[model samples]
Target: MIRIAQLSCGAEYSGIQRELERAAEIVGAKMISPEVSLEDVMDVEKRFGVSVPSGDLNLIMARATRLVENPDLADAVFVATCFRCAEGAIIRGEVRRYIHEHSRLPVLSYSFTERTTAETLLTRMEALVTTARMRGLLARERQTGLTAGIDSGSTTTKAVIMRDNQIIGRGWVPTTEVIKSAEEAFQQALQESGVKREEIQGIGVTGYGRFLVGKHFDAKLIQEEITVNSKGAVFLANAQKGPATVIDIGGMDNKAISVQDGVPGSFTMGGICAGASGRFLELTARRLGVNITDLGKLALRGSYKSVPMNSYCIVFGTQSLVNSLSKGARPEDVAMAACHSVAEQVFEQQLQEVEVKQPVIMVGGTSLIEGLPKAMEDLLGIEIIVPNHAQYIGAVGAALLVSGMLEV
Candidate 1:
């Protein structure tokens, strides 16, 4: 039986421990969590050269260190922390590094806050267990047959063709009718790749309109956007050796996905309100009498720092932009301010339940807005990675899924 060492700050969360136990059962793993106390923390700090800060994180690190050192404790380690606590982030990074350097055990990390739902945590824990069981099994023979993946996103439909594990063709179209857009994108890709429909062995569909496309086109595989996006980002960034965080800014929404060992451990999505998504930028650009394509360049030209917009609703935020313009704020300043507002909304609202780690991969059509990634990087204090074909990554990921290269 696989044994997993579960470590956490032990913060008071209503029914969270029970949920963790349930997750272990679902993943077929026996959970072992050692009791941590203040004295234990101090001893670890003194004896093992591990720093113990004055907070709940101190307890978590002490317990985690013991689990890492004791080979008999478990076959894998799982760490949980509160996303809102800055100390938790520090502890998570430190403990993850220590475990990786000291032992060869698989480690998974999760962040929970007041708003974290049980369903979300369970999904991540299951993915972690699946990854652990499948580790070191990535070696596979190259696939020769043609496979295709279609991503019918809210804003655009994208398609890609893969042959011999290489992207032979890709296409995208602004979404109007879901089925029509998907058909167009797929046909374009097929034309470019010169791969006939009869030759394609498998077809996978993903994104918001996945079901619509899957039902209409008879797709062989259907998967959630978060799962496919994680697979795609990891492949595009070539970061399969380590963990990565994928920030995908789509047309109507945004998603932050934490990928541990090529599988999605956890993910967070923007609220129903379109305040923090690509639509916000498009609306704000039109209100400012600038094309959406030019908004990024205009923001970069701003000479003054703009005040952060505080409205949580996109409608109210658009009005605020107009008010700022009426108050003699420069167009460039307002554009920059809108970009900052988008980043603020993502971090404060969308990502309140997840700890964002480095080597962040930015994707989606909204990510093409040059200033948004820069704004996010400035706010997060980390460099952001934008791949060459960021917009079509979901389609690429779907194709990879069809090729049996990544686990769903």
Candidate 2:
């Protein structure tokens, strides 16, 4: 169904706008405009403090089937593209609330550090549907009870409730202080699942911030991300697949791993770089006048020469992009350049200690960017395979792990 997309990445707003053209290509997809609904326009005043323009909000609020039947013509829209530049996940939290209150369609939100692609973007959307379907089966009947897993990623918090390895409910929220976000999203999934707190047999937490909340969980499993990630990946990847490298771009950090036998064996981290994580891509997308979700598809054009961006520092990059534009650099080129630098840096970091595994797994929000994986895979000379549930990996693993565990 054609729907409105409300994108609020970080600072690089101009970069995003120029990158999200693919979103406009969805068969029935309609880009938001003033003609559809009021609340979705860029800086469209909140008339009477209730609704504004652009049908993005209404579309989100409306059921998908109904949207298909009585499709809102004013489907597409562009937000400020730069609401809270450095607010981190706080802005995401607020954005989610805004999309929830305004639109009737299921909001398709994606964040980036460098750039993502269409395949990666669809993988996330697929994860949501798969999780929802898995949730349906648990409702039929069960005896072992249900469990919830909380993946406290550096940028976002995702929770899943499952019974017998099947997802019963899921929740995705930005990470605002690890423990707090975990608690909040945990409660949300429980409420959404309509399952009582006591009914939850166990809880698992993963990612960089997992430790902070591990103490609070029903039973915290402080294992490597590769372990938890593979647990989730194997479920989504084709059975014919073999050893692979997984590159997970979180909001605050980046992880690279080698997985074989459906388990993580070796891995590395690039520390935390606000200038080059999934959120940065989002900010850049917004700056370029495109949606982050549309970044990868737009970048696929790859014809123009890239505009040079000196530093990966967010603020510096923002200023540099403006100066580059003034210097007459093509927007497409500039966006791809930013993605290139990030890919180069990631490859350098991942290849520092160990050789990168072939058939790589590109997970997290950054993977969804259109051309990012292509660029990175080329640089690393390896195949990159992004799984369907990449974003929900930590949450899904934690949930499945907790489902059969005895109380600890």
The most accurate candidate by lDDT is 1
Q: After superposition, how far is residue 271 of candidate 1 from its true place, in Å?
A: 8.1
| lDDT tens digits by residue: candidate 1, 320-357 | 88888888888988888888888777876655444477
Candidate 2 lDDT tens digits, 60-105: 2232223333435324322322322334333333343343234422
lDDT (0 to 1) per candidate? 0.74, 0.56
TM-score of each: 0.72, 0.57
Ten residues in sequence with the least summed lDDT for candidate 1 = 135-144
Looking at candidate 1, what is the lDDT of residue 252?
79
